[model samples]
Target: MNVKNVYIAYTNCITPLGFDVDSNVQAIANGVSGIRLQENSTLMTAPFYAGVIDSDKLNTAFAALSDAKATRLEKMMVLALDPIIKKSGVELNAKTALILSTTKGNITVLNENAVPVPDAYLHQLAQNIVDFFGFTTQPIVVSNACVSGIMAVSVAKRLVQAGLYDNVFVISGDEVSEFVLSGFNSFQAMSDVPCKPYSANRKGVTLGEAAAAALVTINNSEAKAKIAGDGSINDANHISGPSRTGEGLVRSIESAFNEAGVTAQNIDYISAHGTATPFNDEMEAVAFNRLGLNEVPVNSLKGYYGHTLGASGLLETVIGLESMARNKVFASMGYDEPGVSQPINVLAANLDTPVNCFLKTASGFGGCNTAVVFQKVNNGR
Candidate 1:
């Protein structure tokens, strides 16, 4: 397939730190943590904090849409689209593709008995967004666990490369519900305090709810972040766990570099998937070191955005692009002490560096991992 030119035209996010893309970038630049105790009684039952969107504001935004029975994910997808469609100045055409990424699609509607829970969840999500926007093309929903968002971008690029569509809208969103929160808690992975990824005092994870959307196109335009290269792989070692040695991550990073025709030395900054859990952080450290990228300035946005689960990959990618454009890398907020033995350089202070190429990676529960390489306009060597 031809390697099509893909640009991230617009990104919108809803996290505890901020709602729009600009606000989120500013919060990260300031090393602001988005995790906080859930003020809602419904969310307060869980011990850990989350990067939750403002419910009242979200509801207000959702209510403006025409669909009366739109699910939470549907609402979020709508919210994500508003900014892009508005900013692009390109009218929402029927030919534009809609590629959605979400592991738990509309799990919030299951308890209400408003829909068939798991089986029809994904279909509902796709159709709801398509119907709302009145798109002529069929909607594609990718449910690849945590790697869904990154994979969505990869798929869009492939499609455009093959000359299938000119525009692709990718949305990644998931809500924090009893089912998801309890499952993580049962695994004893819920952090009582805010999550501290890649830190010596790191404990467990804190669940976060987030919605992120990016607009991409084959057309090279002035208003988007270009997609340089991307890679993905499966561990095949475990079904619901990451490899202890981070073997899959290593391969994925290598593959991404190869696709970009660049080497490890070319990446100046790495947006790592630092989940703060013991195994995840250590495995990432080993994987990064093995790839000879140990000295690369690395920071995990999990400290700022908490783990947005399905939305983590894309949300972090957005942050990486914004940081690179501004030529500033922010420190990992929750890191107090070093955790791993490997010589990984975790950012301790925001640094002004000439960032050219960046690698964004994410590893999920299903032994899936992906890496995406990006370069600034006129910045690639």
Candidate 2:
């Protein structure tokens, strides 16, 4: 048996800020936020802050690809993956695979007055994209709550390492809809203003919508970053809350560190899952402190993109890769002061620094937590 090293060949994303990776990077660098006060009776009764993509812009871009009837979420998924697949120039054969990550795939269809559509099924949503791209392998769906995106990366790495596939294309997306809005509102987690992750004045999460795609392959010709290691663990503590001791997140990071052969000191930066929720932020702070990463520069993109849910992990991962490549760390928007009981270095201002290795983490409902370590490729090593 032999092991293969996986590298991120290419990446792209569709967000309210921009369509491609470069645009999104510029937006973040400029401190631009996609989350805004959205007023739409169709999605929610009262005005709330969220990161909703422009429907017209999405349709206009998607129209160029295909006129075939597809749901809004489907359109986003396809749009996010199209450029990456074309750029990679990989053959769509049995040895190549497609993985879709989303917690609510086509879940908006249930809000319609008409009969339910088959696309509401996760597999069906995936099938639509698979058929559109003509992928020969059965599409794999990783929908483990909010960890779905980064977990998809872990899945791809394992598949390629095991020789199950030579190339794996991963795309993740979720749209802001009435269902999600109402669900968060019901939990009293919908913030009145744009979310401020890890801030004393933080209220709650501001929902967001986005689609991000990445190419995981044994090829390193155009590698953006090497996927060194990853881990996903469930604490089984609660249904919707995280562990009080941050045990799950701590273990998840430790697993990633052990596999990557790097400790907390080696992590130059951290893209944390700061959802702006009290429990989540505190849990992450405790976890980092437990892992002796308190002084590490950490930031959460939730302030700019809000909580993008299933799309968040990979979206942040893509942004983190860009940060490493550009040698700059974007500010953790909305973080004014320390809000958590534990001490952690939450970046309030953008820093121009060299980032060699970084960690991306996500925690979600059902006590799920995932962590992945990525390092910049040097001299094609």
The best candidate in terms of lDDT? 2
Write down the lDDT that model 1 would get.
0.80
| Candidate 1 lDDT tens digits, 1-381 | 445667776778877776688988887777788787776656546355877777777788777755477666677778877678667665557558889888887776666675546434687788788777777788898888878878888888777767788888888888777777888888888787888888988988877878888887865564346677887888878976789888888998888888788888889899998888888888899999999999999998887877888888888887888777888888987888899878799998898997888999889888999988887766231
lDDT of 2 by residue, 123-154 (tens): 99999999999999999999999999999999
RMSD of 1: 2.4
Candidates in order have lDDT scores of: 0.80, 0.92
Every model's Cα RMSD, please? 2.4, 1.2
Q: Give each model a TM-score.
A: 0.93, 0.98
Which residue pairs clash in candidate 1? none
Alpha carbon deviation, residue 201, candidate 1 (Å):
0.8
> Candidate 1, which ten residues in sequence have the lowest lDDT sum?
39-48
